[model samples]
Target: MTQQASLVALQERVAAVNDVLNATSVLTWDSRTMMPAGGAETRGHQIATLTRIARDLLLAPETERALEEAERAVLEFAEDSAERRMVQQTRHAVEHHKRVPASLIQERAALRTVAQAAWIEARSKSDFSIFSSFLAKTVELSRAYADCIGWNGHPYDAMVSIYELGETAASLKDLFKELRAGLLPILDDARSRPQPRSDFLFRDFPEEGQRAFGLSLAERLGYDFRRGRLDTTVHPFEVSFTRNDVRITTRYNRNYLPASVFGTAHETGHGLYEQGVDQAFTRTTLATDLVGLYAVGGTSFGAHESQSRLWENHIVRSRTFWQLHFPELQMHFPDQLGDVSAEEFYRAVTRVEPGFIRVEADELTYDLHIMLRVDIECALMDGSLAVNDLPEAWNAAIKRDLDLSVPNDAYGVLQDVHWSTGYIGSFPTYTIGNVMGAQLMETLRRQKPSLDASITAGEYSVLAEELRTKVWQHGRRFMRDELLERITGRRLDPAPYLAYLRSKYAA
Candidate 1:
């Protein structure tokens, strides 16, 4: 066949591979949010089969030849266009998929399926030992994955790449080192300040009221209920199989208000990003971040965090924000919010607190939570840390950094399910994204200084639209660094994040 015909065939083959991936994505989303316990085994096999088929298609010799033909054509035709970028991205996927043994791919898929099931049981029983072996297997799988993928910088980099796309161990180390140096002293000073009163937030907020408040907040933020539905899950997360079928989950604590409220806001931010991706890009090679994996990795995650943080901190916790919504809150939880003034409520939510669980950690100590997790992941990958002793190590890190002790395993090691899924060296992205969010917010404020006023009045679409224009619509079309530079006029600077924390906590 002519090279042109070969390239056309390859395009069809690539689309078929993407179709399988997209189908599996739908199944995975369903398995996580809606599948019954009885369906785990069947779903596991289904996902495993689809993954193997997709890998084979991706690794096919014909596909490789087509890619070579396409590469030559792209280089000769439109090397600087988005089409060339898509070709390059396809090449990257082909190379990465071919590097690993198909057996390794299938094994990891099966293991992840089992591990997730075991994790659900262990988390339910609050028994770390039940999941320890599974976690060990996960570690073994991750180690093999690293070896298969290979890394120029660190073994950890190979593992981290699946999520962050181009992030290296060496780069993160330098970034985190600078972040720690700047943050630790400030947290130390803030720890000595009188803690703000937040009795209102800790008081009983009926679950029904929390759901109503969350749904209302989502609607106000421009989330379409027809496209997305909020539900309860063991952990709060947003999963979207398609733009129109996105789903978000939040866990509610009847005694703590922000858990559900901010969780909803955070996941809603994710949903908004999914929904905002230009519909025309859907089902094409350009559907997601095609700029570069690393760029897409950093900016997309950062963008999601920005939306969540904007609604959670800049809007939900603001005094004026409280004034506009406090009456509704009072109506929902009369006994809880009746005596609380907006100033009192705002101070309460923003109070500096060092906590064991990263998700529940307040703003001042949130990055510290991330740093501890980063250290632990690095240690676990490098053979210095053992799965069995993770709990003790976890408590030690908490005590050293937060001046707190683990009251129980539930609130300690079992708190986050990230490790259960073999997500190592990924937590730092939360801190990185938080900083990026603040940077974007700072830039947004400068561009539209009245943004705070709109947020205060519970008008979020204007700000959401602003973000949709600058960040969301692109959908991984630019590398993370270039995207940040494009939008904020600077590289990834943690100074804005540190500054935001300092002003909020140390001031």
Candidate 2:
């Protein structure tokens, strides 16, 4: 076959596979967002089937020959052309999937569907017993899959690499140590000070007003509702079927207003990143080779986390941000916030509180939640921590780390959807993003020192446009390391982030 013919075949294959994968996303999204309890079992099988189909298409025998032809053809293009990059990406994914069986992938997907439903029930009932068996099944499956793909010594390393490419447990330990060292002193000092009274935030906030206000704030964060929408979920998250169909979810709390305002902003950050990817790369890997779109997908989990943290922590929780939006928020909940000044409100919301739920954790105490998960998950994988013992260990870790007591299983082990979804080694990425987001914000502040001024003026598009130009438009065109360096002139460093935290809270 002619080289051009091979490239054409490769594109067609990629587009076809993406269609199935996107379909899987749609079904998964529907199940989470709209599916009835009666359909959960069937939906699990349907999602699994679609996942397997996508895997099969990508691994078909003809793909290897086509990849070889396309690689040659792509090299003939300029070194930096998108077509060349796509060829490199497709090849990397094909090779990686070769290492793991398609059946295993399908099984994991099917289990995750049922497991997620189980988690919802378990969390609702606040019963760890309901989810424990599913957790064990997932851990076993994940362990097997990790062994299959390869692990140097720690099986969790392989699982983590599935998310962060080259990240390992030890490396993450080092990163966390760096983050903790910087975060600790500030946490102590802030605790010693007179804490801000934020009782207004926990007053009665009606759901409809909260949703409407959250929707408006999401758009201001640069979420394009034309290409996206917001919904409710058991656990708040964002998903993208394609650049054109990015969707976000936030679980609102009537008593705690930040859950709507900041939670929606967090998901909106993810939505904006998805919507900002160049339309040219739609239904295709952003680049070929170093990591295919799949590996790129891995990079994205962390990258996307950075976006969410930036919006949620750095911006939404900032005093200046509230200076502009406080009145608007007051209009929505005057009974609750009418007397609260922006400064007092900011201090109230950002007050450091080590909590049971990771989703609602304060910025400083948030990583404490992740640290517990990483240790517990690693132990689970290594046979040191049994699934049945998870709640005990979890409560102990929370006590040890945050000095907070776990009252029950829901707040302890059944809180997150990650375990049920067959994901491990991914928790560290949130901490990584927390640090990276801080560093990136430092760079952003330098680039646009007037960022606070614009924000205080009820303007945020400038920040959104800046991120789009520097970080979002490329999609997976670059690896995470390369993308960070390109944007910030340095790879992931926690120093800038630490420095920001100390300066902000200390002052």
lDDT of 1 by residue, 198-220 (tens): 77788878899999988988887
Q: In candidate 1, where is summed lDDT lowest over 10 consecutive residues?
A: 289-298
- Could you give candidate 2's per-residue lDDT for residues 1-507 as a string of tens digits? 776787788877777788777778788788888999778888889988887787788888777777788988777787657778788777767777888787888788889888998999999999988988999999998898888878886889988876677788888888888777878888888778887797888899999899989988898887888988899988888888778888899988888887778879888888888888887777776611122223122245678789889988888888788877888888988888778888888888888877788888887788878988998989999999999988888888989888988998888888899998887778988988887788788888888889868777767888888888888888877767788898789988988887878887885
| TM-score for each candidate, following the candidate numbering | 0.91, 0.96
Worst 10-residue stretch by lDDT in candidate 2? 287-296
Query: In the order shown, what is each candidate's alpha-carbon RMSD?
Result: 3.0, 2.1
Instruction: Spell out the clash pairs found in candidate 1.
Output: 289-476, 295-479, 295-480
Best by TM-score: 2
Which candidate leads in lDDT?
Answer: 2
